[model samples]
Target: MYYIGIDLGTSAVKLLLMDEKGTVHKVVSKEYPICFPHPGWSEQSPEDWYAQSIEGIRELTADCEKEMVAGIGCGGQMHGLVALDDQDRVIRPAILWNDGRTAKQTEDLNQRIGKETLSKYTANIAFAGFTAPKLLWMREEEPENFARIEKIMLPKDYLSYCLSGVHCTDYSDASGTLLLDVEHKCWSREMLEICGVSEKQLPKLYESYEVVGTLKPELARGLGLSADVKIVAGAGDNAAAAVGTGTVGDGKCNISLGTSGTIFISSRKFGVDAHNALHSFAHADGHYHLMGCMLSAAACNKWWMEEILKTEDYAGEQAGIHKLGENQVFYLPYLMGERSPHNDPDARACFIGMSMDTGREEMTQAVLEGVAFALRDSLEVAKSLGIHLERTKICGGGAKSALWKRIIANVMNLKVDVIASEEGPGLGGAILAAVGCGEFADVEEAAAKLVRVVDTVEPEPELAAKYEERYAKFRKLYPALKETF
Candidate 1:
């Protein structure tokens, strides 16, 4: 049997086909426009996502026997607000996860409602990118639209509804919505009232591997598949990536350094940081995980290498960055404000401690080191909660860089294991589909068989000592600039 995995990303929808043995048969990607109505606001049409996904799926499985396709799953961008009217038509363009228009609303929730109370109800503090704050912003800014809202959904759940005719979301995705009682794995009534919405307005929640329903007959016909193809409730992007890397079970860690960076740690027992800096969310593997997210990761390098430096050769630029932790120059990777630990949206990126003799390689090294240091900030929070990580499985675009992986290993003082297949969430979704179809016994069993570590980057004692000193200084820079930022 074959399984299909749809990754509904911010810029495009990527479809993947994998057989029972975990061999990738084909992959297809379709792009769509991301609209910026204002300076900091990002939006996309739900219609665009559905159109592109349908077209991409047809292309992905063109050569396969369509009847052999047993199941479909999706791993998608989380926290985007998609509203529907009484007739089930899209009410407005989706407010994206990167959208920052809800700064005021986030502040209001943290202040007026109190962070302690909010965390008690939702196991998370309000953030500008969270769905509940965006809903609150919609209510205040567009009262007419708010009144017309018959249902509210996340980005991928909208696609799930279009395919399965079932309004449902997975636990990992719902954990970020600020409407879920994450510790209890249910909708929080207090949070529902605070957002001025009801439980009926929300989609039914499911575990990531649970089969939501079969694809709609019309959708199945259009895609040249049978109506019996099951659709599994997939996870949020980060959680899905964690599953793909086999970062399941207790004390396992996965670090993703994509456009945004995240440090995800899985735990058998529920745990929340004292500061609520790290997100305490239910994992797709039916356990719990704490995540620390940084808004900018490889993106800072992209900006420097492409926009500022006027070059597209990322590997060439990184070729000369041989010296690890001895560079004098330091950079703060906050290009798009920040999320985990600091949680300050006004924080700006900076290149500090640069000398007149600072070379191009030194500046490049600083960018890499800066991101590692910021990841360490979150690791410190996890440590405060007594979650000690000795090693982590690494994934994402930035994880492709050998130097970056080595730097991360030393800077965090943990072994960084490189997976054999690094397709992240999309591949994970396919694995979930395979499990849902009974090809595997359970998530952990499927992961243990599928996830392979090709190489391990061990932290050198000398390099780790140097990075420890540098990290101490890097941690102070944020506090020093906090008052001004």
Candidate 2:
């Protein structure tokens, strides 16, 4: 039997085919446009997601035996608000996860409603990216559209509803919406009241690997698949990536350096910090995990290498950077305004400590080290809780760089393991599909059997000591510059 994983990303929909044995057969991707109506607003058409997803699935399964396709699962950009009216038509464009138009709404929720009460109810403080703040923004700015909402769903849930004719979301995805009682794995009544919504407006929740519904007969035939194919409720992008990297069970960690960077620590027991800096959310493995996210990760490198440097040769630019924690220049990786550890939306990217002798190499090395140091800020919080981890699995586009791997390992004083398959959410969705079809016992078992580490990068004690001093200085720069920002 076969399974299909659909990754509904912010910019594109990617589809991949896998057999029950965990071998990938084919993969396809389709791109779409993102609209920026205002300076800080981001939106996308739900219709574009559905159309591209259908096309990508058709291409992904073109050569396979359509009758053998057993299930379909999707992992997508979390916290995007997708609303439908009474007739089930989309009310407006979806507000994306990176959209920052809800600053006022977020401040109101975190201050007036209070962070202590929010952490008690949802295990999280309100961020501008979360779905509830987007709802509040809609209610205050576009009350007419808010009044027409019959159902509220996340990005992937919209695709699942279109494919299976069932409005559903998984616990791992719902955790980021600021609507779920994450510790109890249910929708919070207080959150519903606070958002001016009822429980009926939300989609039914399921475990990440649980089967929600079967594909609609017409839809299955159009995509050249079986009507009996199961539809599994997949997770948020980060959680799905964690599953793909085998970062499940207690005391395990994975650092994802995708568009956004996250330090993900999986745990059997639920926990939240007093300050609510790290997010306590449900994992795809039916457990709990804490994550600290930076708004921009590899994106900073891309912006620097491609736009400022006027070259696409990332490796060529990085090849010139040989200084190890000795450069005088320093950079702040706040291109998109940081999230974790520092919830400042106005924090802009800048360079400091440059001299006349500071060449391109020094600045380039600072860009990489800056990201690593920022990630360490979150690790420092984890250490404060006395939950110590010596190493973490690394994935995403930035993880492909051996130089960055060494930098992160030494800077964080942890061994970094590189996995054999770095497919992230697409592969994890396929694994969830396999589990939903009864091919595996559960998410943990499936992950243990399918994921493998191909190599490891060990931290150098001498370099770790050097980065320790550099990190001390790096942490201070942000605080001093906050007033100026």
Candidate 3:
């Protein structure tokens, strides 16, 4: 049997075809436009996502035996607000996870409802990127549209509905909506009342690997697939990425350095940080995981190399950087505000401690180190919660850089394991599909058999000591600038 994984991303929908043995048969990607109607606001059409996904799936399975495709699963961008009308049509463009238009709404929730009370209800404080705040923003600003909402869906759930004709979401994805009682694994009635929405408006939640429904006949026929193709409720992007890296059992860890950076730690037991610095969410593996997210990661390097430096040669620029912790310049990676520990959307990126002698290479190195240092901040929070991590599997576009990987390992003082395949969430989605189709006994067995680590980057004590001092200074820069940011 074969399984399909659909990664509904912010910029594109990527489809992957995998056989029962875990080999990737084919992969296809289709791009779509991301709209910004106002500053700090990001939106995308649900229709565009569906259209691209369908096209991508056709291209992905073009050469294969379509009847062999047993199941389909999705790993999607989380916290996007996608509402449907009475007729099941998209009410408006989806508000993306990166959208920061709900600052006022987020502040209102934290202040009026109180952070303690909010955390008690949902195990998380309000953030500008959370779905509940976005819904609140729409309710207050666009009451007409909010009034017409019949179904509230996340980005990938919308695709799931289009494919399977089932209005459902996975627990991993629902955990981010701020409408879930994450600790209890159910919808929070208090949160629903506060948002002025009812439980009926939400999709039925399922464990990430559970089969939700079969593909719709029309969708199956259009893709040259059978109507019996099962659809599994997949996870949010971070959890899916964790699964892809085999971070399933207790004490396992995975670090993703994509547009956003995340430190994902899996645990058999559920735990929430006292300050809510890390997200306490359901894992794709039917347990629990804690995640700390940084808004900007690889994008910091992109901004410096492309927008400011006016060069597309990222490798060429990075090649000039040799001195790691010796550089005097420091950078703060908060370009798109921040999340996790800080939770400040007003925070801005800064390059501090620059001098006349500061060369281009040093500044470039600073950008890389800045991201690593910021990631370490989250690691510190996890440490405070008594979740000590010795090593972490690294994935994402930024993880491609050997220098960046070394920097991360040394800064965090942990062994950074590089996986053989770094496909992230898309691959994880396929793995979930395989499990749902009974290709494997369970998530643990599937992950243990499929995921392989190609190499490990060990931290040198000397380099770790240097970064330790640097990190001390780096930690202070944020607090010093907090009042101004």
Q: Candidate 1, residues 1-485: lDDT per residue as tens digits?
A: 99998888877888889888887888888999999898778899999999999998899878999999999889888889999998889999999887888999999999999999988998899988899999999999998999899899998889989999999999999999999999999999999898899898899999999999998999888889999999999999899899889998899999998778899999888877768899989998998999999988988888888888899888898998887889888899988688999888878789999888998889888999999999999999988888778999998879999999999999999999999877788888998899898999888998999888999999999999999999989999988998887
lDDT (C-alpha) at residue 122 in model 3: 87
Best by lDDT: 3
- Model 2's C-alpha root-mean-square deviation from the true structure amounts to 1.3
- What lDDT score belongs to each candidate, Candidate 1 first? 0.90, 0.91, 0.92
**Residue 481 displacement in candidate 2 (angstroms):** 1.2
For residue 341, model 3's alpha carbon misses the true position, in angstroms, by 0.7
If ranked by TM-score, best first, what sequence of candidates would result?
A: 3, 2, 1
- C-alpha root-mean-square deviation, each candidate: 1.4, 1.3, 1.2
**lDDT: worst 10-residue window of model 1:** 420-429
Which wins on TM-score, candidate 1 or candidate 3?
Answer: 3
Count the clashes in each prediction. 0, 0, 0
Residue 262 of model 3, lDDT score = 94
TM of each candidate vs. truth: 0.97, 0.97, 0.98
Candidates 1 and 2 compared: the better one by lDDT is 2
TM-score, cand. 1? 0.97
